[model samples]
Target: MTADKIKAAALAHFANHGYSGASLSGIASDVGIKTPSIYAHFKNKDELFLAVTEEAIAREWEQATAYFKNRSSSFKEKLYGFLRSQKENYDEDERAKFWLRTSYFPPEHLHDQVMKDVYNLLDKMETLLLQEFKEAKEQEPQLNSLNIEHAAKAYIALLDGVFVELLYGGERRTEERLEASWYMYERALFS
Candidate 1:
């Protein structure tokens, strides 16, 4: 579909060249269409960028939520599964990489929008994590001793840190760091 093609091209362009550097004409050309044809699917470049970001975030959430939904295990198992899922989500596809890059570092003009989007995404993720923490507390009374809010925030921060490190370092190092962080988190929260 033209819409998908546009999104794919936009994502690639945005990833390689921030928002301002990427042009609608270039995306249209990537899709083998005229610049005006993009107007049919998106009213403007901002709309197109937002659409691509929303789609990428939705897909990532869908994958993570689905994985969590099918899992029925102990709270510790669920926690580990969630950590692994978060890593997998960060090992994103091209579109997702674009979204992540923009979320963390966007063009000056689009920085506000990117910040708002990142806050919204983080809020949603925090809500999900808080629910998991609450469930863990209910299932294991020992978790009651832990500060659920602090633990949840720490867990999210740990994932974010690992993502940044992985982007620079390779998968093997990332995995090692992730495991080390996971152990620390598990010991602190579960033990």
Candidate 2:
């Protein structure tokens, strides 16, 4: 329970302040404990950060798994649903924002591990998408002309662009951008 509270506080702090700016002292204060107590749960800030990162990734994977398990019928519907759901899932929330911020702007010392996490998630995403695309192709021979690998790459790139937009583009514009971009992407791929 204390460890969870510590992690929750750390996630919010890191999301708002970035790595160097966040402090164990502050996290302890938020958790209503002394700084040293944090050491009971986490060896150091690095460990805590990585733990939080892992938790965030796990949360995302769980969400995606649930979404895909109960996903739509058509291939386009599945793709669009997953894409839009990500935007909804990650927008401005503490855990998601912390994960996104750390992913793109990790502390210099943890760059390699952060990137590894990114690659791991991407691989998982691609695997899921490839399965869907292959199934779609099997169902409609017309889609067989669409290269699954290429489509997966393009879709990941589109998702990355949306993440970048979320960081820089204000909330008001994000939905509009997503709609317009999704339309263009669908047209280019399907039409």
Candidate 3:
């Protein structure tokens, strides 16, 4: 339970402050423990940071799995929902914030390690979306000429663009970007 509590506090601190800015002392203080108490659960700050990062990645992956697992939603709903969830989650979820921040703005010292994790997620995401797009192309005659791989990559590109807007473009801009991106995405798939 101490470890879990520590991770919870660490996640918040990391989400708010980032890898370089987050502190074990501050995390421990938030957890109502001494700085040294953290050593009982983590060897060092890098270890603790990675622990939190790994947990965030797992949580995000699970969310995506849940979205893709639902059998009832039409592909368009599922696909758009996935894109929209990026904004919703970033705005409303702390774990999502940490995942986004760490994925894009990792600590310079941990860049290689952080990127390894990010690339693994990207590969998995592409594989899943590619399958979904392939199925969509099969199910919708409108998508007869759609190139599934290109669509998948473009979709992820749109998602990445949305990520940039979310981080710095403010709420109105992020919404506008999402709306425009979705419109273009729909045109690409349906036109």
Give lDDT per model, in order: 0.80, 0.86, 0.91
State in Å the error of residue 110, model 1: 1.4
Query: What's the TM-score of every candidate structure?
Result: 0.84, 0.93, 0.97
Ranking by lDDT: 3, 2, 1
- Compose the digit string of candidate 3's lDDT tens values, residues 1-191: 99999999999999999988898999999999999999999999999989999999999899998889997988888888888888999999999999999999998999999999999999999999988888877888988888888989898999999999988899999999999989988877776
- The candidate that achieves the highest lDDT relative to the unseen native structure: 3
Clashes in model 2: which pairs?
none
Residue 120 CA displacement from its true place in model 3, Å: 0.7
Give me the overall lDDT of model 2.
Answer: 0.86
- Clash pairs detected, candidate 1: none
- Clashes in each model (backbone N, CA, C under 3 Å)? 0, 0, 0
- What tens digits encode model 1's per-residue C-alpha lDDT throughout 1-191? 99999999998998778788899999999999999999999999989988887787777677656765664688778767766766675675676668667777766767787688778878888888888788778878788788889988998898787777656777888889889988988888766
lDDT of 2 by residue, 35-73 (tens): 999999999999999999999989878877777777445
Off by over 4 Å in 1: none
Best candidate, TM-score: 3
Q: Residue 157 deviation, candidate 2, in Å? A: 0.4
